[model samples]
Target: MSEVALLLQKQVSKGSWVNDKKVALIVSGVVLAMMVAFLIVPILSILSRSFAVSDGFGLENYINTLGTSRIWELGLNSVVMASLAASIAVSLAYAYAYALQRTDLPFKGILRIVIMVPLFAPSLVQAQGLIFLLGRNGVFNRFLGFDIDIYGFWGVTLANSLYTFPYAFLILSAALAVSDARLYESAVVMGAKPFRIFRTVTLPSTRYGIFAAIFVAFSLSITDFGNAVVIGGNFNVLATEIYNKVIGQGQFGLGAVVGVMLLMPAVISKLLEKQISKRQHAQVTDQSTPLQIRPNRLRNLVFGSYAWTIAAIFLSVPLIVFVASIVKLWPYNMAFSLKHYAFDVQNGTAPLWNSVGVAFATAFLGVVVVASAAIVSAKFKTVLSGPISFLSILPASIPGMVLGLGYVLAFNNPSNPFNMLYGTFPLIVLLYIYYNHAQGFLISSTSLKQISSTFDEASTMLGGSTLRTLFKVTLPLIWPTLLGVGVFFFMRAMVSLSAVIFLITPQTQVAAVSVLQLSDRGAANQAAAFSVCIMLIVIAMLLVVRLVLWLAGAKNVTLIR
Candidate 1:
């Protein structure tokens, strides 16, 4: 036989090229098309409108937006608040994470759980909780015989700190959880002081995590709308400015300008996050031993006190909401009542049900959309692979409010074919899937990478098709991670505000928006009641997922943070 023929025969015998690449190509094409239509187009639409003027395309909008003294003031305000919030959140989160992950603290599990309570509700809930405790007629002020204003810069900063700190805690906890114990042992043997060891060893080890936490906290604080909307008062920031421009003034052009302005910090933070994430993963090693904390009474006591303080702060929101929900009147009547629980009387339970429906649809559809793209990018090499992967994660860099505005500008016009879905429920689901796609894609892609391609080869050798191998072998193994993605999607969509705030109409009102409305209408008790309902629903859904995973014998599944 000829040499080429002999090589071809050898390859055929090895079963490496048996499966066609058409499947990968086809999947890649579909993913690319969807991303272009949904993600890329909308952003371009917003950018396009920002430059449009009545005469023709020009910088009139940009000039007007940037020329204004108020815009500059708002920008400065956003930067100052974001910086302060980031600093405070990172300090508290680092302490809380170290306590739970590196110290012999008692009740660490409960503390960790309490820290994550903020994640179960909207960021506005924290603002509401702050109001309940410190507003003019607040419980604390009434009891202490002093009025404290919870409506301006201080309120925004404090509420944002509470809302954004949990994210930092999760990142720092993961970083602290993975380290080489041998380094600590060596330092101990060399007679390193505890403080010195912490300064050199611990600080250097978690440096990337610290940066990650700061960037994430900054991005979240700057982009956050819920907390700012509730307590911002006359404190103008870019996010609230965008809300005012679009909803309050009907200035789509000006809103787009602010959207672009907000994108700068988000993009910078996301870039830093990506680089730090790459560096932080190096902490995990094959030969590394997990760090174990030995009982040191003084050390444990200090860290435990710090952890409990943070837990109390974190729990304050939900606790206040629960109490305020059942109370008949604030600061006047101490008597408990069930009247606020009758959410059906005013806004009814439809908004809550709508939120559940949106969340469910997002979870199911998000998995399918993100997983297909992940599978193709993870397993196959194609020209579209790089672009597909980049597009999949680009949503994380885009703020939810910007993306929502993009959707409005992109889909609500007659020139767009997607105009049919302008106010429909599916548009909200699609917006959410795009808004939160990055994390799910990362999880699915990581899981797929850990799986062996040998399974595919073996299946091919056994006369199974590519589809059969994927279904019978690949998917079954990664279902646990997929389940985690589903739960994450559900939780985020249930509590989502920014992405859907611009999208909701009278018919498509959701619980989060409803809470905002109630609070805006001065129905504090009803808003609190609604906030509590959302939290309970999220918790119950989490429990249901955990139960399902347990019944399925999936012990490795992590359904919550």
Candidate 2:
């Protein structure tokens, strides 16, 4: 005990009254336990249920899973679709990022925003747009005088690519942008041809990012229910299978099995992304700037045209859907009308507001949880630091479905003391934390690393308490990141559904799920209207965030890297 006390004292300091590190260590253990509870409980429940029979923990669930050929078909379809979508998305993003970083393109800012237009689109809304453009009676068929059957494998690939391209673009662009220019300069000095220079310098430098993009995009597509439900006519990806099994038939046991299956790729992608992000946090200096390609007029025009054409096509699909929403009868009604905009608020507007209220609550609670978790792990070092850090990243690896199911199985049990939180608005807010916790941690850590440790030392020397220094110094310095976290978490909660789907009861139906339901019910016009509303809300939020930043005289305002 004496040695242990001595060790602890040596580790922190003698003068300190409160062992901040010890407190951090104890709190971290509790948080890690909660994290494990959030991760393992539901997954284990499904696994145990699968095994349990009239006999015991046996292979009954495996047999049940095997018997469902349709289940197997969905898995196979998901892998294929993800592969195709990721391949197309990465290639397209590479070209787009290449164009953005390499060529001297005109209207670069406009093109960038245009390409990211999909981010504002609610998942259901994007699918609605795809239907309007490619469904048998879609505007594309009428406008081009061709019956475009866009609701199948081809449609899934296109829609998935469109939705995921932005992620690939953002990631790969940063990867390329950070490459050292001297490498390219040396290769050129050696008289290497342009293509050879690209082969040796640019391509090799971004190889990791390219591969990362592929996995990240593929996993996202596999887990995405939005595109799969809309364009995937009998495509039956794992995500849609989960939806069909659970929501359509109320087959909770089967849905839990499918949910576990769908969670695999998402978990893998999240792990790889976290790894990439850790490495990506390394600062790129002025010397690391890639050699700006002074493309010849012909080459510049070619790459520029490639990017523009792809951007226009992807963005146009949604625009066409928005336009079709107003047509009383698409392809027949040439004149526009506002009939589609007639929102039936009485039927479900209340539910939408419930979702919005949940979202706001999520943002509020998420900030508190993130700020506390971040401060604990970051400011106070303790034995659990390593575990705290590891658990903080667990949410990133686990899919929303996995986490949501965990909550259900853990909290849904009648005997559980915490069961009261199940199916409540608080459950949705907690789901947001389960998914977005890692992001908030990242935002906090990045901001913390920028600050000097000397500030804390100086504050302590001036007789300032740890709490006082935190309030007056640390908080002020990291306020920008905190604000960014608020927006990021809010947006994520607003747009998220995979996990929230399970947590949200009938009384608490979210807009995202509603959009999915609307699309599934073939209420294309209403879905479009909801999609438009989601986009407008996001736009408004972004504008408000920006305005708030400006008002506070803060120059930095991006919510995510």
What would the TM-scores of all predictions be? Answer: 0.95, 0.91
Per-residue lDDT of candidate 2, residues 39-131 (tens digit): 556567766655666777676666787687877887888888888989999998998998888888888877888877777765555567777
TM-score of 2: 0.91
Q: Which ten residues in a row have the lowest lDDT in candidate 2?
A: 1-10
Stretches of candidate 1 off by over 4 Å are 1-19, 276-281, 284-289, 344-347
| Candidate 2 residue runs with Cα over 4 Å from true position | 1-15, 19-30, 33-40, 54-56, 269-290, 293-295
Which of the numbered candidates is closest to the native, going by highest lDDT?
1
lDDT against the true structure, each candidate? 0.87, 0.74
Q: Write the per-residue lDDT of candidate 1 for residues 379-494, one digit (tens) a residue.
A: 66688899999999999889999999999999999988889999999999999999998989988998898987667667655655556778999999999788889888998998
TM-score computed on alpha carbons, candidate 1: 0.95
Report the error of model 1 at residue 445, Å.
1.0
